[model samples]
Target chain A: MRLLIVEDEADLRVALTMSLEEDGYVIDSAEDGEEGLYKAMNWDYDVIILDIMMPKMDGWDVLAELRKEKNTPVLILTARGAIDDRVKGLDLGSDDFLVKPFDMAELSARLRALIRRAAGKTSTVLTYRGLQLDTAKKTVSVDAIAVQLTALEYALVQFLLMHQDTVVSRTDLYEHLFNEDDDSLSNVLDVHVCNARRKLGGTYIKTRRGLGYTIGD
Target chain B: MNKYRSIRWQLMAWQRFLLAAVLITLLSLHYHLRRKSEIAEVDASLQSALMSVMPAVAPMMGRGGPPPYEPNSNAPPPRYEPDEENNPLIIAETYLEEIESNGYYVTSWDTEKGLMLSVGAVPASASLGNYELIVETPHFLTLNGNRELVVTHNTDLIIVIGRPLTDVNLALKKTRYQLLLVGSLVFLIGHIGGGIIIRRTLQPIREISQTAEEIARGDHSRRIELAAAPEELASLAQTLNNSFNHLDSALEAQIRFSADASHELRTPIAVIMAQTQAALKRDRSTEEYKTILQACLRAGIRMRTMADSLLELTRISGNGSVLNMALTNLSEVISSAVEEATQLSENHPLSFQTLENSRPVQIDPERIHQVLMNLISNAVKHNPDGCTIRISQKETAEWAILEIADEGTGIPVDALPHIFERFYRVDESRSRESGGSGLGLSIVKSIIETHGGTIEAASIPGQGTTFTIQLPLNPASDR
Candidate 1:
């Protein structure tokens, strides 16, 4: 999954990016509300972490503007513990909120939940035929046998299984699994797909010629 | 206690008490004075009756010869000699009859012969002593059947003349009744009227209290209606309104300060927590561990600096007891402060200018030094290296002025006024990296103010920024 972090504090922003990036997610960051809003409207991020206080514009204005154009899942990150701030953020169309000095584990877990809920998957586990993918554990298994997969391969498999029976185009897969900083000319996507097929079994994955990949009966 | 709860009620109670007392006193005075004058008139009439009867009775007492008798001045003489039936006694009886016809009871008692003559049927209960008592002064008495009487005595003839006081007493009784009725009516009317007037007069105060209650309940926009207030209460209302205005602004500032302080502290806390959490997630190289620990240390230092700034700000602004004042040379203090500040920032070019005739000013030297250090360091930090930071002092008749001007990138026009606000920064991202806790200017302003001084900032938004501080020369002496 891809995420956007919009925060003003430099050290906090860098720490959040580094920590969240380690949780098997592609991250894009903006230093202020204006840049954050611009990126949010232009990208297909699974979730956006917003900060309330910022320069150029505030998080509220950015969220209001972004809500007018997109339904991207938003989790507000604020230093204010005031209930009024929480209520206001939620009323302004934020999917979740986390106060500052929050545990990274909780933040990562909430992001995952938001992404899953946005994809219309109620459970943490996604299944395709006899293969099981546990999103929380970040692991995949074929017929009760665990298969070790790289972070990128696991992301690709999860995306395909989330859209089971539908062909996910290469462009959609790349947008979801990689951030803007990733090289577009790289053949990493095909290599990850081939590895997932070998590990999870060949019958569970299928690729539409001249289109994309799918997981179906 | 409940009755006095209302100011109008209390005012009415006191006023009605005074009114009732005044009315009763006047009414009693009128009643007593009227009764007194009526008794005097009755006594005068009794004395006059005595004067008239005395001459006629004297002739009857003499009886030396047939007393010259006249029956109407123009009538013919008596045809026969004065008979026993028509002697001087008959003449005396005629005079007595005249006095009796005028509501006077006349009686003559011969002390020598023990003879007594009475007319107008004086009540038996009238106290006419048998002894040879001669009281010439008139006096009052109540005869039987409660007839008020006035009586007087003559010494020579021992004649007593008495008059019933029925008419005088009746008139006085009526007047007393009327005075009581009128007094009661006046008291009732005055109290009712007074109550209404008092309530109306205090209506503005009630409104002011109601408005104050609403404001206390958090409706900050409400104010006392100055135009509608009574003249007596307008000043009070205005003063109360001024206090409310000040308190409202003070509370708003406190709330904003709390929010800013929390935000300032939370960022560093978040940085440390995030870095530590990320570092402990898995085993990492020694270099990675070193990097994470360094970031946490930086965050910790920032938090500590911010905490110290907040404490200093609170101590300076909270009260005046923290200031240790003394008489000292203003230029010397400025020189020492500049020397210390120069040592703190060697890259910045600092220049100090002082008045030639610098006088000793009353100030807290340590606090003044702190203020100078803060302002100088702020100039150094906000400006680029090698930018000129000038410190100058000037003296007026009653003021010692200090100006710290910087020739660096000035603050933006919008952020200039808020530069001294707690936790405010011109550029948040840049200032955080430069390790500015944002409370430097705030603490400086507090220290200056605590020393009975004023501070103002002027910025041209890219030209430069200048901070001018004015300290009173004798702050501790007169005040």
Candidate 2:
């Protein structure tokens, strides 16, 4: 899964990025609302974590501008505990809200729920042709047998499994595979695809020439 | 027990007291004047009669010329029966009748002959005084059970004269009744009409007091609705309303300040909690754990800094501008502030430089140093690591001015005026991200003002910002 955190607090931003990255999410972040808005509009993210108070602009303006052009799911984060502030953030088309000083586990669960709901799947586990990806446990299985896969390989498979029938372009795969801080120009995606094919019996992973990767029977 | 007296009641009581006193004085004066004039008229009638009768009767009794009527000595006989044609009885009878007809009575005596003659009704009991003009004025006496006023003359014979005084008494009684009726009506009218006028004039004050009471009961919205009140009470209502508005705004400010301070604290707390959770997620190398600990420490320090700044700001507000004065070297204070800021800062190197010497100023040194630290720290917090902040000084004859200028992303022009106000953030996100409590400039301003100084901000967007502070060399002693 992929996520974007738009927060201005340097320490909180860095800490959240590290935590979500460890939870098997490719997380990108911006230090202020303007940069956050630009990146959010430019990329296809599974979920965007937005802060209501930010420099240059605020999450409301970002959400309003983004809703005009995109349907990316957004989860709001704020320090304000006032119900009015929370309601205002949600009323501006954010998908969910979490007050600051929240538990990392709770944030992780909410993000997973948002991503699953966005993918049109009602469960944390997605299956295709006897292959299952347990999103919460970060594990995969083939025909009732667990397949030990690297974190990147697991992420690639889960992304393919969630989309299932749609043709995911190289750009979309590359964009979701790594965050803004990673060296996306490298062959990390190709190597991860090679490793996933070698592990998944090499036939279920199919690539269309001049298109991107896909998963089908 | 409390005495619950309305303003109208007190007013009416005072008005009634003053009216009754005035009417009593005027009615008594009128009664005395009427009686005095009536007595004088009767005396004049009696005197004219005595003058005519003394001359004519003396010739008829043959005791000629002003001598026979000496009241204490001998006199002519009344039996001589002055000539019917020449006697004074016949000569003065018609003249005396004229005075007598207007309610006078006449009597005369001959001392040597020991005889008396009189006309008109006599009193059932009356005492006559010896005839002398210098002795007594006329007085009212009872005659035939009727009141009369009599006078005397003694040039040739004892002569006593009188007029009935019954009309004077009846006039006084009628006047008393008329005055009593008119005075009661006037009092009644004044009581009701004046009471209404007073209440109308004071209606604004009554409304204001009622509104104030309602406000005290926690409805801050109520106000006096007096439109056509008198000028003095109108101004009173305005002043009271103004104070209520000020109090309401002060309460609003208090609420906003707390909300803002809590907002500044939450992000750092979130960072600390997230970092701790991440570290304990799984086994990690010593280096990674150290890095997590460092992150936690930085977040904790940020929270502490914000908390401290908020506390300082509130303390200054509570204490107002009361300074603990001390005579101190201004340059040394600036030098120490620069040293402390440079020494304590790890990420950003903030520098302060001064250009001129200063006489020792009367100020609270610790507080002024705190103000200097706040200004420099604010600069360091906002700008990048390499940005240089310059502190310079100049002086007029009476004031010492210090300028803090920064080479960084400057504030916008519109934000300059409110930069020193409490909880006023030019950029809310940046202020919170930089770990500011939004009270730094306000604290600096308050401390400067405590030293009897003024502070202002000047900024150019994308270039730099400058803060100028002017402190008096000598604070006002009278304050």
Candidate 3:
């Protein structure tokens, strides 16, 4: 995946670049808003991780500019965990948001989700094995039996299914479904998985011991 | 000084009244004692006169000799022929005349001759040797010595004996006039002295009062003069100056706090905006575009949270007394928060454990919920992968305690004290990564205090950290 990182902090940019590069993503970095915007407009990237605070132009303006020319998926990385910024960014055509100091695994997962979403592949009408997800109807079917899911559960299952056959870490799951800075507790992911498993049957999603969860055919 | 002018009248009036009362009392006492002494002198003189005259007159009356002329009597004599030709009688008469002229009258009675030996021109029918004597005149003398004499005594005798009274009266009148003049002078002097003394005494007080008034009107620098004033007034002035110093310090602190808060908020907002604009300036691949967008979103969220927290902290600090408290089911509140936190963290596991005897606590549920959310969120954001976060509740005898513990990079001991301070971040790099506003913990502390609760944080470097919140159970009922 090709991704662009726009951050003013040199250390943070280096850390993020190193982390994303390890995940097989071709990384391009910009130190400030002007350079980041120049790079974003010139290149075709699967996802963009833009910081809100920079020298010349801000994240909001960047998002607006990117949206003007393309419907490409964009993810905003900010140091703030505020609601209005998220709404504003999303309103300006941001695909998702990740607060700073985020884990490497979560950043990878969000990139994957944004890529899949940009390709118009975020759907639930497909299935692996006896599990089926119908995005149009907002329902999940297993072995031809309709399975009901809460909105959050459906999103969780869709995320799992999109990255099927791959180990999706808890941090990645959190970033995809929620923003960065989410409270890290052992039961939060467990509870959601428990709910999803209960509706879709436990065997469809496999827990990988200490690493994360995987869906397989 | 114009500052002291306002209280000048009040100070002067009080002093004048006090001095006038004291002076009037002293002058009145002086006059009263003087009058009493003069009356005493008159009584003593009257008693002495009566004592001397009564004793002298009683002995004369006891002797049975011819009645002696009083020497101060005046009476008309009866018509007597050859009274002047009788040379022997004339000489006796002349002696009588000399005595009579000296204010006396003499008479002698001869029982054999059936004639009264009269001198000093006594009345003809008047007898000098009779026990029952009726002079039948305006001026009559009963000698009480067997004689009767009609003698007109000068009515001015008492006047002559009291002749020294003129000198006394003149002295008394002079004294009275002097007393009137002196009393009036003393009263006037006392009033003026009293007014001057009172004004002098209250001068400092007036200055201090006016200084206080100016200070109250927002002139915080106003100070009263303490030099050369009375001890008490000096101390009062010093105290006032000290209070103004404190006020000035407080105002300075408030100004500093606002400036710092604004500075902190503006930097992050500006950075986010600038970075995003930089990102948008380039053309990129789908992945690059996505990454740029993600960075923008993150910065946007950070700015928003900072702004929100700043607002919350300001609100909490502005007024602390008004708390919207209600009966809250703490367990339910915790459960709901846990559920929301879990949903937000797609795969991160969260655990919840509660004591079986947990009960509802009275608090502003929303505020307490925010506190729990902040603590739990912090734990989650700071921890390493595969680390477990524990959310648990326990009840003590007096409080309900909720704890959020995380196995993460713990806080340094040096940073612990300042963790709850506004805009304080431990490990700035990591804090920026975690997208912290630095106001979360501060807001949590403020909310807990408002609910009459306590919160404490303990951490071990590279091990873990736990945030404990203890809320007073039934706080409303206790009150």
Candidate 4:
């Protein structure tokens, strides 16, 4: 996928471009708003990563100018985490935004999501070892047979499917699936996995004791 | 009474010293002048008396008449005696003695009573015949007597007069008492006058000092009265009051500004974070995951826009002079804003119109673009899909006016005035759900105000709402 980064800070820009490039993205960079606007107007990009504070022109101007031309998906990067700035950018027709000093995983995920949204693919489905889940329909089908699953069981299956063959710790699963009031236990994740396994009629999920769980074909 | 009591001791001590010195000086001068005048009077009287008797005595001595009264050649020369009751020499002698007791002393030898004998130790040279005069002595005075006695037969009699020294001392003592009394009275008056003046002069200063103390104790409103005070002090008081006013106003503004800034920052951060957290708490199918991801993207976009607007507002607040400003066509700006807003709304029905002969306005294009985007997006966000958003632009001789009207649920009247305030939302819950950070109108107002334009909102409860922006066409356009 092709991406453009509009950032004034050289170090952050280099870091982001390298990271995104490593993630299989063809990265183009603009040092400031003028260049960003020019690049955005002339070239097609899967996503535009913009910073609010830049020289020549600012992120808002570039975003407004881009919106005037095309509906290119833009993800703003700003040091100011204030919501009003976010709202103003969105109100000006930006696709998404990420605050500075963010984890690379979150950025990548957001970038993926923005690309998916721009491509008009609202329903995202994932399949692993005959366990298939349709995200938009909120339904789970196991081996061409629909399986009734609770919210938690379904979330556990989905997490296992996304990180197939990679160990996900209990803390990671709990943080992603449960609210604060949920009494999370290592055994509770085990129970949910057991229930999902029983419903799938297979032993697809594997547990590395004292470490985490993984899904394998 | 209290006022007098305060300085009573001081007054008393000062008066005592002054009175003592004045009394001493007055007594000394009185004694000096009294002694001088008494001596002059005595001399004048003695001279006059001597002149009267000299003629009588001088003829007798010239005729050698005293030989007629020579009692005997011996027998102590008979101690020549005048008629016992009516002798002029005896009368003059008594008068001299009286004047001497009154501080004027006289000494004399009477010719009728003396056989060359002196009554007050009068000097013989001083009593030479027919040569009468006054003299000052340590203990007495002497004058020439009328009778003359001489071996030369031509001189007949000699008269003498004198005064004792004790009488001059007596008169000086009497004058000392009178001077002491007068000086005491003058000093008493001086002390009373000084006390009154000092008290009057210090009263205002004392009041001011007390008022200052009260103010230091946290009575911020304590103020000194300027009436009846000197001009310089009054001006100082006025300056202090002015400074207090400025301090109060600055403090109030700072408090209000901080509160508004914090409130504006809090709501959106809370919403984005809460929504993200909520979305993360679920596991979803492909579509559910996309929906959750989309929601996150929406929130992320919302937060970014808010940050951008906030940065813009802060930058404009710092220095508005750097904005790229130019003469812009209002109709074009409105049309573009509406078109972009329609796209953002996924092609919500939007209508646009322009008055005939519309004039262009001078503005910062980027900021005005922000303003129009914010306003139109706000209108579309609050309205249902396919609701008509009418945008119009017109130009008078003085101003270029642009307006956006929406048939959405209008803002509540109570919230109208506060709509332009940062993060002030009429419907907080609804705004959060609609992905609004509530800074749209604030940014719009900031942009419009930066361009020297005015924006106002008018809304009906159920009918519709309109926001109008008026920008000055030129510097002399009003003229």
Scored by DockQ, the top model is: 1
> Tens digits of per-residue lDDT for model 3 on B290-359?
6666666676787688778778777886354556777777888888888888865644578998777677
Backbone clashes in model 4: 51
Go through the candidates in order and give each one's DockQ. Answer: 0.70, 0.51, 0.02, 0.02
Q: Model 1 reproduces what portion of true contacts? A: 0.76
Poorly placed runs, candidate 4 (over 4 Å): A1-217, B1-254, B263-304, B317-329, B335-339, B345-349, B355-362, B395-398, B473-479
Name the lDDT value of residue A87 in candidate 4: 91
Model 3 scores what on Cα lDDT? Answer: 0.65
Q: Is the docking of candidate 1 incorrect, acceptable, medium or high quality?
A: medium
Model 4: what is its DockQ? Answer: 0.02
lDDT of 2 by residue, B1-479 (tens): 12328776677778778877887788778777876776566555445554545554323222121112223336432222222343224447543433233332234333222222343322222222332223144444546533333433222223344444556567777977887888888878887887788878767777888899999999988777767888888888888888999988887788888777777678778888988898888999999899988888878887788778887777776363566777877788888888888865665555666645577788788888888888777777777554677788778888888888888788888778889876678887667656666778888887777667898888888878888889898768634
For model 3, the superposed segments whose C-alpha errors exceed 4 Å read A1-217, B1-12, B43-252, B268-304, B327-329, B346-348, B355-362, B384-386, B394-399, B429-435, B473-478
Residue pairs whose backbone atoms clash in candidate 1: B148-B165
lDDT of 3 by residue, A93-124 (tens): 88888765454456666776676676467642
Per-residue lDDT, model 3, residue A160, is 81
Per-residue lDDT of A59-110 in model 1, one digit per residue for the tens?
Answer: 9999999999899999999888789999999999999999998999899889
lDDT of 1 by residue, B1-479 (tens): 88788777778878998998899889989888897788777656555655555566444333321223232348643232223443323467654443433333334433322222333322223343433333456454545423223333432233444555567778988998899899989998998889888888888888988999999899998999869666779999989989999998989888888778887788888989999898888899999888888888999999999988888887779478887878888889889988888787767878999888888888888888888888877777777555788989898898999998988888888898898888788877778888889888888888888877899999887678899999998776456
